[model samples]
Target: MTQPDFSQRLHGIIPPVVTPLKPDFTVDESALRRVIRHLLDSGVHGLFLLGSTSEVVFMDAPARREVLRIAVDEVAGRVPLLAGVIDPTTDRVIAHARDALAAGVDGLVVTAPFYTRTSQAEIAEHFRAIRVAVDLPIMAYDIPVCVNVKLERSTLKQLRREGLIEGLKDSSGDDTNFRLLARECAEDPDFRLFTGSELMVDTAFLVGAHGCVPGLGNVDPAAYVALYDAAMREDWTEARRLQERLIRVFNIVFQGTPRTSAGASGVGGFKTALKLLGIIEHHHMHRPNLPLNDEETVRVAEILRAEGLLPAQERKLVPGV
Candidate 1:
């Protein structure tokens, strides 16, 4: 089979579209479609569904597919849609990959197998197995915080060289390390490198990283799109300004900490902001992962207000909401 090439379209602000939920914690397709519409309307470059922002690990197989199905249908190729086939083992990821392929995703975002540590070689083979079972463009998702293993720079380069993965989503939160990798691959324009550093989008683009997968983009996609636009124009000052403002907006993720899991706080704050913006109906999170309380929801709104995302004294939907 001829391998697909997605490196070109995968660049820019590809926010991990969060899985909007119901009071029952089921996937809310209607709200999800609305979220997709909102993102496209904001001129986002791409949509990453069933990602960490979508609570992929916490969802069942059916729910994961449902989110992918909704995203693929709603996006309809307007912007590239990348699906996360994340799981604990190669076979599990392959199963998710098959479902993602069947759902018609433009590409797949995979991680090293987690919960059972393996060597770098084993990780390479994990990605190889998925590509063999399901032919499609793949992006390595390097999120060591969740997976407990870093997809080393050397390993990733080898994968790209072998054409096993066409791009990378570096959520390792180590921009210094990523900086070197980005510089090394500066000549390979097709090997897309997107940083998940919610706070340093300007630095990412400044260092030759191709794009961003900011979780905060769920709350403010247009801001990120603007940041990317600025960086592309080489307007470092504007890019820095946008990134600095975004740093304040990122405070929402902290509102739920100490009271909830880091995952819950980050994702819940996003869901709450979406709810406040009227993009989604509810901010409900999956079980064992508590949703933000009324107090935290109010604080999220306050952050949005401070960031100019909402009217300072009023509570009304934003332009895109």
Candidate 2:
């Protein structure tokens, strides 16, 4: 398996893959491999495991390790593999980072410490410590919503200047901050700036973003790949058209509304859609995270049908129907 050249920049669509689970809540290796194959066939640029979409915060160490190992083996170096080292402290994150690197991942994706409030200086030290402890490339995961700490522009610039991080996956949803960081980082040809926003991929690209890590890419990777290609070709019209279509399909994330929480809605939606596409066998999320109910499953099926994702003959076939 040939690894990606970390010396070069990483760009294009990388899906934060959902971790498929069995009825007993164990990692479903077969279904996971199927999902990986489906994404690869769809022409995704890379695989991101143990991300928020993967429910890493809720999963234990064993489950996370299993997911990373399976992804590395299935991917076989066809593209770069980024495994999330999401923890509340530096030591714990370093532990996961070591495990992921040993499992053959090409890079590590880390977020600011959660569960405990951290100052900007402490956050910088967190990343600096990880970079010192690990030998692989590190990509900063800026998810302020979950981590409760924003990676400020000055901090990011400092990190980049000091070579503490090679890239960023900004899911902060702050357009102004994103653009500022993108503008400042534009001078470094090797600094990868990836938007975790599926809805704003075109806007991000237009402003010099290098790539995207969309959760929706797990469902329709070809669409994202097409969008990235169009953007790369500088065809804003075509890119916008494709992005709008994807946004419509992204509505499935809201299907659990008025009943389930947003997190449950998103995970259940993506897993159910995968099952409908016959890419995975089960749509079960991990324990404590609710799956879509009977009625919600029907709604998901309808959404897929309207989006032309379900086969005409199987339009009437709902899960457990």
Candidate 3:
């Protein structure tokens, strides 16, 4: 399984596709298929399943396997599918990586260990181990807020030099960090870099990022597609105008929530907004954190409606009616 030639095709918007669960918390296969179809039709460049937005943190092994199978089968090469392998232990993470690859994922989106501090050597070892185990393109998920380990410039360049990793997802929300990483990897045209922050889409492109995997892209896929097009076309005025609208919605979703749990709410917001758009069955969320309360849901509805992301006709279809 040679790695895909991502050097040419990796640049674009790839949403971390969320998992749709039934009322009993089982994977909603039909809903999952429908969401992917909707996203692809809506114009996301690729589909990345089982990533953080899919609550990989809370999903069990069997559930993860099922998701990989369903995504691979349904997508069937219509677009690229990268399964998210987010485990705290390197050995177990390697197992998941091999399994996901066998299921026909186009690439591997992996993050370093979390909860405990791991040295840079450990981080490098974790990624190198996976690279050796699977022959797919490895996109390092450098999200320190969740993984507790950040892939700095030197480490990424080291991995690139060794041919052990191909690209990185810079979720650190630091423009300077991405700038440094971009500069360090500038010489290696094959080493792709993506920004995980939606607000910084323009800045990331300006700094030589390959693309973005933004949470908001789940709700505003067409808008994001347009932004990417404008940027690629060098139309800064159009891209900035669209990004401002996205940033407004982002600020609302992130407000009054702890940083760790902020992404959880954003995932919920995407599902909620999806329901409002009449694109899904329900705005269902996995347990332990119930779907947003009525007031919060109403507020999210109001903000999206105001932004024109949600129309009045569709807002009536949300759950908790």
Candidate 4:
């Protein structure tokens, strides 16, 4: 495949979309479409399918392809679509990349190989091999919390310099390291850098992040977009207000912690919040992961109400919660 010219910088509030599910654990097509439409209608710059927030690791190849197909159909290219070709090995990721290409995604978000330990050099080669196979622009997902190995700044720089990746999704929680990289790559205007931290988007923008991929974006996309707009206008005070409001909204993710695993807590909270906000029908999560209970659901509602996301007229409470 001839490499497409990725000259256009993918900047702005691109959300990592949530995969809404039926109680039977099947993809709820209507709910999913509603969620996609919600994000797009809110003027989100782009949509990221199959990210950690999307529960990509819980899905098989065919399910992932189906989700991408639905997203492509729903979007129809109104904005750029970055597909998460996340898998355990290089060849596996390449396979997903081919599917994403066939599905007509604008870019690929990849990560260091998980479930197997590899050195920084091997990790570098992993990304290189994928780039060798796929022509789509790539974004290195630096999420050490889940993958166990950090995509060190040096390896990321090497990938960027060698043209293996066009951007980064920094979820490693290392602000200093992220700042250093944002400084090092300051000259490359096309190298889009995004922060996965929903709470620190204001600070990340201060350090020159091109955009954000917040999980909370699935719950409240407009606020993220508004925060981005405020930052672009250099309105730090408004940006800080919006960011703090989002931080409070983020409290929903903890409503189910300890009882639920970390992944379930975060994703389930978003799903539950979406359900309460009347965007999705059910808050069901992927199998082997528990959904938020009624008590937790009530707490999520309280957080939404506190954030003013839940209004009296539009209140839709889950039965018995």
lDDT of 1 at 11: 82
Q: Which residues of candidate 2, in runs, are more than 4 Å off?
A: 1-4, 7-9, 314-321
* Alpha-carbon deviation at 73 in model 2, angstroms: 0.8
Q: For residue 175, what is the lDDT in candidate 2?
A: 89
Q: Write the per-residue lDDT of candidate 4 for residues 1-321, one digit (tens) a residue.
A: 223344364788989999988777778889999999999999999899999999999889888998999999999988888999998899999999999999999899999998999999999999999988987889999998888999998898899889898889999999999999999988987788999999999999989999999999999999999999999999999999999999989999998889999879999999999989888988888988888998899889888988788885546565743
Residue 235 of candidate 4: its Cα lDDT?
98
RMSD in order of candidates: 2.9, 1.8, 2.1, 1.7
Model 4 clashing residue pairs (backbone): none
User: What is the C-alpha local distance difference test score of each model?
Assistant: 0.89, 0.88, 0.80, 0.90
State the weakest 10-residue window (summed lDDT) of model 4: 1-10
Model 3 root-mean-square deviation: 2.1
**Which pairs of residues collide in candidate 1?**
none
lDDT winner, 3 or 4: 4
Query: With candidate 4 superimposed using the best TM-score fit, by how many Å does residue 2's alpha carbon deviate from the native?
Result: 9.7
- Model 3 clash number: 0
| Lowest summed lDDT window (length 10), candidate 2 | 1-10
**TM-score between model 2 and native:** 0.96
The runs of at least 3 residues in candidate 1 whose Cα sits more than 4 Å from the true structure, single-residue gaps closed, are: 1-5, 316-321
